[model samples]
Target: MANDLSLNKEQILDAAEQALKRYGPDKTSVVDVARALQVSHGTLYRHFASKAALREAVTERWLRRSIAEPLAQATGLPQGGSAAERLRLWLDTLIAAKRAHAAEDPELFAMYAAVTMEAAEMIDAHIDGLILQMASIIEDGITAGELRPGRPETIARAIFIATSRFHHPAHAREWNAERTDRDYDSVWELILAGLALPTA
Candidate 1:
């Protein structure tokens, strides 16, 4: 008996993920998801209108829980620390999230590469959210006199672009390379110098 009287989108997404794992992205159908949840197709349709919509929801959910949420939690920014330290924590949190996702869900991580391209709009929003987060820290840095006065968004975007290799899914293969952390540290050194924040 399907006790889905209180079923929600999150529950639908959870079922969809299981279907995806079994069928991969290309083969996973709405029916598969509905079947997994032991619900009718109309029930699933109420949450996600189409397979594409379902994919986008899955992508958005992954980006939120895996990346954006963690970074926000790691640094509730615009706080008391020098911006450099906050940025370090923020960037480290990002790198750690990416690495963990790749390692923990290698199959999904690989499959997501294809879905992400199709979900460009969602990806853009996610990137924008992360940049805004960094911008908050940068704004605080300027106020604290640890960084040069400038547009926070522009600076945040630049830093994000510069450090994309660490967090970008395309670089998952290189994440485990022996030189990865050393390379990341080197980039951090350059970024720190540019920020004019005191390093200890």
Candidate 2:
């Protein structure tokens, strides 16, 4: 119930997110968002070119939450913290965030999963963005002399793929299994050991 004249793009996106949460992505539409804001469809379209564009924007916003803040912390690891610690924090935080989303509302999470699949371009960009963030952390580790010499981009992608189960939407349901935390610990330890330089 937002006033049309005062509405902005963020307001539209917020209303759209709520609509998607309530009616789901498949049933939700630009018109619904407009109705929520008490605006005309034309007004909404003035902000977003099309429904698909709006959906992509919303998806980007959702994906950004998992990357933007966490990447900053991962790249800015505290003094005395190893790259392994930063990597572990990144992976663990992502898993927890995904789990929190599901716990908050399984239906909404499911809707997003579906929307994600439909928005292929946005998903590709999201994955690329994650890889770039991971690479930056890996490069930082190398630069700090905490990790062995190697191609950071390759290592970053390997790490991302290695920890896929913890954050991938397809594996969302299995994240809470009793052994999942144990599994993550084992994987993290293995990666840390592999990446660390051998002592003389």
**Top lDDT model:** 1
Per-residue accuracy of model 2 over 35-64 as CA lDDT, tens digit each: 888888988988888777777788778778
Query: Which parts of model 1 are misplaced by more than 4 Å?
Result: 1-5, 77-80, 197-200
Backbone Cα, N, C clashes tallied per candidate: 0, 0
TM-score of 2: 0.86
Candidate 1 displacement at residue 134 in angstroms: 0.7
- Which whole-number lDDT from 0 to 100 does residue 22 have in model 1? 78
Best by TM-score: 1
Consecutive 10-residue window with the lowest summed lDDT within model 2: 71-80
lDDT of 1 by residue, 88-164 (tens): 98998888877888898787787666666777878889999999999999898899888988899999999999998
Off by over 4 Å in 2: 1-6, 49-52
